[model samples]
Target chain A: MTHLKTKHRLLADKAMLWIVCLFATLTAVPLFAILGEVLLRGYDQLSWSFFTETTPTAYKAMKAIEAGEPIPGGIANGIIGTMIMLGMAAIVAVPTGILCGAFLAENPKNRFSQTVSYLTDLLQGTPSVIIGIVTYMWVVVPMKGYSAIAGSVALFVMMLPLIIRSTEETLKILPASLKEAGLALGGNRARVMLKVQLPAAFGGIFTGVLLAISRVIGETAPLMFTALGCSFIRFSIDKPISAVPLLIWEFFNDPNLQELIWGASLFLLLFVLTLNLTAKYLAKKWNQ
Target chain B: MESVKPILEFNKTCVSYTKQTMAVKYVSAAIDRNTITAIMGPSGCGKSTLLRAANLMHELYPNIRVDGEILLNGENILSMEPVDVRRRIGMVFQRPAPFPTMSITDNVLAGYALNGIRLSKAEREETVERCLKSVALWDEVKDVLNKKGTFLSGGQQQRLCIARALAMKPDVLLMDEPTSALDPIATAHIEKLMQELQKEVTILIVTHNMGQAMRISSKSMFMYLGELVEYGDTATMFSTPKDERTKAYLTGRMG
Candidate 1:
């Protein structure tokens, strides 16, 4: 009977190991498959001119893809517009988020701070699509046209809650001993937050900002309403703007514009991928 | 020894963290300038609280209420600006709480940076060297001045914290269990450093280690249950404690 029990136990262990291996494979296979498909399908469209040339009009989509042929239009205008909108979003979101986070974490009982935290939670839970629609109605429609400025407002709203939540959590995790040490060293409250608390939490806050940027860079729904797609290059925030997502949307709908759609999709994918990698690198470096 | 004014005087100081609990009650003591005064007690006996109150460090807690005057160099530190008061009386915590983000050299010079006091490059270097030497850490850490302060051993980190405190050149140094976190060898190093440091700065240390209190302290005060049980020369207190509680504590009959 004892020998029979030992054999059964060994079989059970083997079964468990098989299940674990199966789970690991299930988790990894799809990611690799998607990455492989993207690389294979997107390789032909990758070129220096893809980044430098403007988006081609409907007439230019008739041209065939040939090796070493400059893609008639580039993504330069979209790239510049994305940079400007994301930059403005960062400028608007970072300070407001950090200050709100600090206040909520440090003085949770203050009425204003409590209200701010409640609003942040509400904003975080609200749908991004709804935010985009609201921006269209309130900002873009009021101004009588789609513009980069309206898109930036939408991105800023999306970025704020992410930064605030991450910064607050980081501050909360900081050891109380650090604050006590600073105060014991004759540092006043503001001085302690500025010099000690902020520095100690710097890595986490930076990662938060990067993650927010990555979240908004490929956002389509929000920019769709705020910055309507344009075939020609335009840098003015007051005018309709072009971005990789909107370009992909417009190009993908036209069956003849397959190569252009794939090229724009590749650019957008690469941009998002680079941002994610940067976020990962920064998080690792700061965590240490 | 030449006579000097007392560096710190706590007059009928009472501290309570809660309405129902008193941490320290009616404690009065005078600490001599340029001498090591050790406050020894069992756990939760309020020795650390008294040390914190001396420098107004207790003010950080909203729930703590402190009554009575804490005179530092003939001024009531309790009434003075807490920032200014703390500038003259630097504190070292029970644990080695060196700023982890700072290098060993920067940790020593942290006070100046946090206070926005700019010193010339030469002056800054000199201060770092002097403070490190004062804490007997110069030789061990000279080669790794740029290394993170948290990389040091527990005792070494504590010494680095002491050096950081001394860099401000404060008139008084308050230590709360400065060696408790360390091993015996590190404890010995810190005890030795404290003995030498007392000659230049007024030292007030709180320790639960009775042997440490007896070895390095010149004047010792015994506290129990938030009251001063005895205050006398270290020799007299350990050899011939007057109070029954003091004798009981020294003989290990009571905590």
Candidate 2:
């Protein structure tokens, strides 16, 4: 009876292992499918002009289709606008988020800090669409028009909690001896944080910032409410701006420009993929 | 002959984590200058707590309360700013923690940097060489001064931590089980270093190793259950412990 039971348990263990492996493979199926589909559909449209030229107008796209020629322009306007907005949002969020995280880590038990920590969680959970609408009311209306500034404000709001959480967690996990050693050397709290704690946490915080940028890069709802999408490449922050995701949405809505959607999507997907992979690589390197 | 004043004194020093529990009971001791004193006890006996009180480390926690007087050069440190007190009293913890982000040379000068004291390029080099040499880590690390401190071996890292503390020229160096995490060979190296160090600064070391206390310290204090059980010369304490508890702990009968 005991021999029979042992054999049965071994069989169950093998079955469990197989089940886990099968589920793991199942989980990766959608990611590979998306990458494959986007690559297949988007490869032809990707060209030198696709990166340098502004989006072709609906009339122009229709004319190109009628003549059996490819679209004349690319998503240069969206690329530039995304870069500008992301840069602006990062400039504000990185420092503010790190400082807030440091405060939370240093005073884990303080009533005010506890409340701020709770608020950070709430802010992180707030939907991107809601943030877009809120930014629209707060920034776009006050400026009397949709602008890149408003779109960046929405992205900034989305990025802050992510950066703050990462910084706080990174700082917290550091051996208490490091901070104590700094303090024992007669350094004040602020100096210790700047000289020791923040430098030590650079990797985690940088990874967090990259992840935040990737997360907001494809946000169309927020941009729709704020930047509102522009056709021509423009540098002005106070004007309606285009983004890669915004261009893809525009392509989806317009029948004549439908062929351009996959190319724009592939660009956005590739950008996000690169950022995520770099962040992961850096995080692993930092651990070592 | 005129008697020299003690460099540090704890007059009824008490550390309480909460109202209900006192980690270190009112424990008073006087430390002579330029001598190594070891605080020895079993785990949870408050030897480490009493040493932490002298450095005002208890101040970092909101719930921890340190009462009575810790006098440095006859001034009450409890009333002084933590920064001012810590500068004069250096500390080394159980683990060898060299700042992972900083180079070995930078780690030596971290005290000055953290205090916002700018050093000339010449002065920076001199200080780093002087501190590392004092800890006997200069020759091994001089070629790789620009390398991160974490690149060093465990024993080297502990010595680097000591060098970092010594860079500030503190009057009293508090080492809380500094070699507890090190191997036997590394522990011996640090113990020897402490003997040479006592000529420059008063050393207060907390150790669980009775053999180490006898080997390095001129004076010894044995604490148990948050109270000082005995205080005397290391030789006398090891050979002729007065308190029943100290005798029990020294004999490995009580922990």
Q: Estimate each model's TM-score.
A: 0.88, 0.98
Fnat for candidate 2 (0 to 1):
0.95
Q: Each model: TM-score of chain B?
A: 0.97, 0.98
RMSD of 2: 1.2
Model 2 lDDT per residue over B1-255, tens place: 212799999999989988999888889999999999999998998989889888888889988999889899899999999999999999999998899999999999999999999999999999999999999999999999999999998999999999999999999999999999999999999999999999898999999899999999999999989998899899999999999999999999998
Best by lDDT: 2
Scored against the true structure, residue B229 in model 2 reaches a CA lDDT of 85
Model 2 score (lDDT): 0.94
Global lDDT for candidate 1?
A: 0.86
Docking class of 2: high
How close to the true structure is residue B4 of candidate 1, measured as C-alpha lDDT? Answer: 65
